[model samples]
Target: MFTDEVVDSVSIQSLWRKSQQSSQESRGCQTRVVHSAEAEAQTVSATISCTQTEPQYQATQQLFPNHDELEPPGLKDFLQRVEDTVIRELVKNAKSHAFDGFQVNWEDHSQLVSCLHCLQHPSAHERGLHVTSVSWSCTGSVIVCAYGRIDDGDWSTEGSCVCTWNLDRRALNPKQADLVIDVPTAVTALCCHPKQPALIAGGLYSGEVVIWDTSRTQDPVLVQTGMSVDSHREPVYQVAWVPMQKKGEFGVLSASSGGRVLIWTVDSDQGRLVLNSAYALVRQQVPHSSSSSFKVSLRIRENTVTNQSTLSEMYFRLKTMLVHVLSLSLSLSGEVQIFDLGRRSLRPAATIEQGDQGQAATCLAFNCQNPHLLAVGKTDGTVGVWQLSTDLTEQSPRESAQLEQIANQVAE
Candidate 1:
């Protein structure tokens, strides 16, 4: 059986065969129409316009078919009679002094605005820090600038620094600062001490208030709030040095966006601030008189200003009426209300509807040197220096009588 299988395998191997192949060549052609890129081009333009205007009042024109027939009577005689009188009056008026020095000036004399200085800090500038606030020292010889972010809303732990320059210094450098105080966080507000030129009060983005004594050589921070329970939980927008009960000593007054205002005194021994008093602004607790037209809500946590003057102005976001605290007068919508702080009434003492109810006032300052000069900072970023009307600021003999009448309002 093995021998027969070997013979059959050799026969099958001999039968393995292959097929042959052939090759041919062919060609075809196609025609195309193409335009030339290097060509001469020409362009033509034509325009036609016509305008014709006829005499106006043609329809109302009364055709004088009989011009001589409708001639005015005694026109020559009337002219002769008034000619002498008109000439005499004209001659007399020309010699009169009523309008001799009068002139109409249609242009304003205050033309160019003066830019004093363009100060900068290289370290803060290189780090892309924005100047949040600026203040002038009491002597007016030095200016301080606080570095922070204004466009960003997110919380940042990025360190901040305050740069100061002595304008009276011979080597005043705009590219560099005379003094730089490194801070722990971004500064939101800065104010130089009204009396002390070396002291500066600042509010930070981290809801802390810091007092920096620039006169100090090593430790610039005199006192600060370090995450204490009595400290502000929200970012402080405003910080001012308010006069304390103790003579010659000042207290720190800070207002936050959370509607809380706290006052603190410097405790240098412990390097901390001691809480003196606190005030919170609440919408429900607001005394709404009947004179108020539209409702208002206390929403501004980003801006606040305080000083030692009797005049004060408050600003709210939505209300057209300026949320002001003045015993003199206030206006909402179109009515000006004169109220008393001592009396508790739902109605105002007197209402004057004919008062200025224009755009709300934001912040203001009174010149202690010049009582008439009042600088008002508006919501539109324009500061208006108003001269108080003599009739308003001037004391009148009838002021007492007017107070008595308001105290006993017989009319409802």
Candidate 2:
């Protein structure tokens, strides 16, 4: 059961004032100094206005029932408060640690992954390394990719490999695995496409991007190479495939170490496979690049069909594209930018850098069921979920309203 509580006027004012104060604190001294005089004048004017309306406001406040005293905050308010508290705590945890990572459970709760006893000095013939990249496949299995030196004394030689873990059984068991690709360079990034169960993409330390089809256990089918265009000069950080449409037109998008985003289309025509680069999106061209921290994160969404009696004829007649590419990029300074395939360039969709400094966003994942919801993991070991506006310029009001309702229910 749930109930909504009408917030008291005084409480609302207090919350607003606190938020303003926090904003002021986030701004540097120059901005604060510049706004101080204006703030004082505005405060005096507000004081005079409040004095004139104090009696009327008190009268109105008295006329309303004292629901705050009787019912307090119900389930909705409690859940919102809990979410705020969790976000704050995660931010604090991230600020305190340098080596941290996050993993989301099946229930969507972000949990900090433990890195215990995994770092050890390699013996005469072995190397000691730590897990650098991780991915979860459709089969519910976890794969950890490592990159480091082979031994404590031998820094001349480096080794990297993918270790598969059976998450369902809660054990690291790659000993009997049928296939394992050994790379001469370090593993920079790894991703398993949502629709292509047999395909896996890996970015290497040598600045090479390799796509592998794991259907054949003995040898993986090499589909494409990403190093020729200098797209992966430093290292490939992230790779993902754009969600496919009903017509089966799909493409893969990858973000490299140099902050370049490349869109590669997957063509399956005439019984052959082809991966072609369609677009290259750079982040510096977008607004607010000075405050950004990381490269763009890519995601895809599938539109749904719904029924509205009054608009059914127009709805069915209107052709809607099912697939879209949504990218989230965090600037090195503290800005998050979002872009879509239809847009001319990337834009700042949402920013969440307040109270977070010296922290780097390491990973991002989107909710399969809710495309508007996204989870971002930072190097400080904190994960935050963000909800986007459901109003779609290309979608109907009924669909947007439904999505808004779902988001509201989930937030509550």
Candidate 3:
């Protein structure tokens, strides 16, 4: 999936404080990935050596009980410890392997590095700026920004807008955005189309999902609302595009804070992009005529209708496809729940209880190199890595081979 520009070697630099003795003291760490000339080598490794200059402090506070505090007191201390541990681990791993080595002078230098570019909103609002979400286009040429924050006092959707910038043209023309669409609701989540760079999906605070065509951003290309169809009641927190299962079909999955996940499909019919189907994330018990305890409610076009057996069957079909769905939810009590959209029950497949000391997970990401490896970041700057294991027999031979290849590359 990488183009020549992307496959080229790149260097990454991380900045951190040099020691606890001084808050102003800073150091830069850089790592470069270069291609090896050996035909037999599929991967290359490097060893970096850096001297530690400062003493680390110990954690002074105990882990707070879940019910004992609304906010954790030891969070800052815990984060500092995590940072020191990370630096130590990086140095250790760099020295353990040897493929090629280069020296970088870490001596403190006081000089300014030129900023390559900058992006800003065309119009400023009375409210403070809080870019809650951002996503890059598939080709990496465009960037989409969403604006809003629940914590912002006097927050309103009046200033909330979705803007896309063309990186290639920005250097030559820095005054205006490539595309700007005023959204009615505060955009909380954004996801670019995996196949189409021009299509951008945005989730709003009003529980609406709007798809904007960046090519012409004055208005949204498609809008899905809860009033017209089934949707989330709470703010949509995340929107992600699912891998396409069929040819000429596009699927998107969105998750809201109200514990709702909706799978939406879009298709072009008669030269118009239309919503083909929307399946709500819900659970229903199989109905029995002899039992009179069956109750059903569905929202349709601003009206709620009560029905029983048919809707239950529809939910059953949705549950059957849960294997392809991976939804994550975090509780204020420091619990992380992973829901399987393919399961028949609404209960989570696995739950990670963060006993007293931990805070709610703030972010989550799956490893591109290994899909089964998941990493979550907590509000306190603590990160947890979880491995999603499956039976060996469950994986096809092609998948098994790919896993083995990745293992060999890591070993190298």
Candidate 4:
């Protein structure tokens, strides 16, 4: 590197002091008025550079810090220091009951019941299509209805429609639905997704299981089980959503009068339902036992049974009991069968005769909030609500022993 030198002027001060010598001596010493001295007018100067000459070094820091480096010093000590204080605060909170009496009772709970809203689709009604199945969304704010010919036994080319209504909407329309999905055939069963608010599964009269995403405006069809070997040969009476092995993915469980209950995984890209598992519930395999006649029929009615797949808090072990609402359309006794899945025997654990004992039951459902409340629909287009006795839902040693004795006898 080339260096440049800068010259700067130096300043000097001249001083004079008063002297104690006589004026004569001062005059003799100061003989000349001005003194002149001549010599070489050059000065030697030294330049020193202050810039560092040592070699410069540069190093890059790592983008990600090591795990050991992330740990702070004396972490155990810090936690120990605050541990006592935290424990003390927690104990104090546990001893306190600030929210003990803040219970809110919002249920009307009146013995009297009333109708809220009767929703209908005008086009479906005009086409002589009646509702075959109805289901509520997981949020309990939306209701889905499947319209089909429940009375027609033969094959129908008539088109049907699925309708949904958002009851929470401010401008609720009873004569119209928020969303209407048209179907080529009658919809036999309808079930809303358990967790998803927009997903809906429907079983068609043609034995096709379809999943519809109401959120999609262009095409609500997410996936469908078209005419294939896996498809049911008869009308599907029930369709339910089941959890899949993968997280956040749901599969469909469909049952048909053809004695098959099939489970399918939705393949969205392929637009089809892939068969995952299948179960055959054949009515012909009914055991002709010498003691009891157990007519195990999957056909609850010509149409889908109301709440056929509903799980009750009775028998499936730890309140997972499944309530089998048997249809009595062919029987005059109008009996509803309660099958306890907790037991292996095919006999119903308990029999309930509610409403008109002679009337035939078309469908039935139990209230989820109250186990004692049961609603039964008759073949004569009548609905009856019955409140069961407390002893029926509760544990009775006498009933248990009686059932056990019967089971032992059957075994013998």
> What lDDT would each prediction earn against the true structure?
0.62, 0.47, 0.55, 0.65
- Tell me the spans in candidate 4 whose CA falls farther than 4 Å from its real position: 1-110, 287-412
Global Cα lDDT for candidate 4: 0.65
TM-score of 4: 0.49
Q: Which ten residues in a row have the lowest lDDT in candidate 2?
A: 311-320
The TM-score that candidate 3 achieves is 0.41
Q: Model 1, 175-275: lDDT tens per residue? A: 78899999878888777888899999999999999999999989998888878877888888788888977898998888888877788888878888888
| Quality of model 1 by C-alpha lDDT | 0.62
Q: Write the per-residue lDDT of candidate 3 for residues 146-231, one digit (tens) a residue.
A: 76654544535554777666666735444355677876667888888877888888788877777777666355666454444466
Q: TM-scores across all candidates?
A: 0.48, 0.38, 0.41, 0.49
- Give the poorly placed runs of model 3, Cα more than 4 Å off: 1-115, 153-159, 170-175, 267-412
Clashes of each: 0, 10, 2, 2
Q: Best by TM-score, which number?
A: 4
User: Which predicted model would earn the best lDDT?
Assistant: 4
TM-score of 1: 0.48
Clashing pairs in 4: 315-321, 316-321
